[model samples]
Target: MIELTRDADVAMITLRRPERRNALDIEHCDALREAVEGATADGVRAMVVTGEGTSFCAGADLDGVYGEAFRESLYAALRATLDTPVPVIAAVNGPAIGAGTQLAIACDLRIASDTAVFGVPTARNGLAVDVWTMRRLVELAGGAAARRIMLSGELFDAGQARHYGLCDRAGDVVAAEEWATELASLAPLALAYNKLVLNSPDAGVEDDRLSAAFDACWASSDIEEARAARQEKRAPLFRGR
Candidate 1:
């Protein structure tokens, strides 16, 4: 599900499940982390991630979305993408929904094609994203836009994403690779240090009190309602508890 290719100091990771619209699962997520590690180990100075088909990533596969194992793998994949030694850019080609948005925000920068759109419908689905994902969303997309995405479940197009600071440029994978190649030519240590400080865990974190609230969202009754609603092919009834 994850494909890694290297051209000198630049590496590209493609989500190759076109048949599934690059929807992620436990195995796919694990493979994604491995791809990042492999690219970094190969001494790449920059990396890029783009999906194989019309959709960047549809979201998490619904088959095993409720399980803890899937959650762990998903977070691990996201963590590896953000914590990569070198810079990573997301070349969003189409719709990036739910975990898709999480994956895009996990990168250092994002370049979106005209077809690109981003949404986090976690509130409607009753599933909650990790705190790290939330922090990054707010950091890149800004506080008000993040609230609209997380609370009101709005979708932003490529132009809107660029306007809101979620997307650094309005372009496709080819353009993203050009940026990555240029970034690779710069001083490696300097780039790494800047990325490290910017992506550091303590940089934009909230107080410990919010930690409990995040955990509660994952373990809430609404999550169970969401699962049942999905199995029954109905809209979720989330009572914010």
Candidate 2:
């Protein structure tokens, strides 16, 4: 239940399955992870994830996530996107609840429509959010705001989301497209490196993964193309090679 489209340098990944509010089933979650990874590997300069219909994502399908195995699998999908190299932008078109909010938080940037709402209602569902998602929520909205949402299980509207720093901006789908285009034009190498560095944990990170990500960019042709294109006063055509 994922839809993928490549326009210019932007890869738009839409969560389809509107009948279920684009809920995350095991297959949908797996497909989403693969779709995002595929887009990054295919040299997509930027990625925008949105959902179809009245809800951006209603969260995990209870039937799919109830089992222990499914829970683990769902967590894996969330972690994959959080650790992905390329920039990920979330376009919240409607209510982003539970795992829906988790997915948005995992992205590098969040642009929500004026009609959108965000919440972590795991407590409402008699459940709890994944550990990494909880940490990222704290990082996004700060301790006080995070506690307000998670502890009290409040469903905040788009304005509250912006106020709490849960989203970077609030507008319509058009605004999301515009923002994606602007971000896609940046030097891919620098953007990727910045994402890597900025995502570094406060505690610590494995040296091997950090070194590999850093070293890989230096060897990418995108770096030379970025410099050359800048010097020539033209836009760089990044192949992500």
lDDT of 2: 0.84
User: Candidate 2: lDDT of 197?
Assistant: 76
**Model 1 spans > 4 angstroms off:** 201-241
Which number leads on lDDT?
1
Output the lDDT of residue 2, model 1: 89
Model 2: per-residue Cα lDDT over 1-241, one tens digit each: 7988999888899999899999998889888988888887887788889999989899989886888777776777777776677788899999999889988898899998887888888777888776777778889998888887888998889998899899999776667778888888876666777787778775245566666667777889988898899899988877656
**Candidate 1 TM-score versus the reference:** 0.83
Over 131-226, each residue of candidate 1 has an lDDT whose tens digit, in order, gives: 777778889989999998989999999988999999999888999999998888654544555676677757444534334444556666766777
Candidate with maximal TM-score: 2
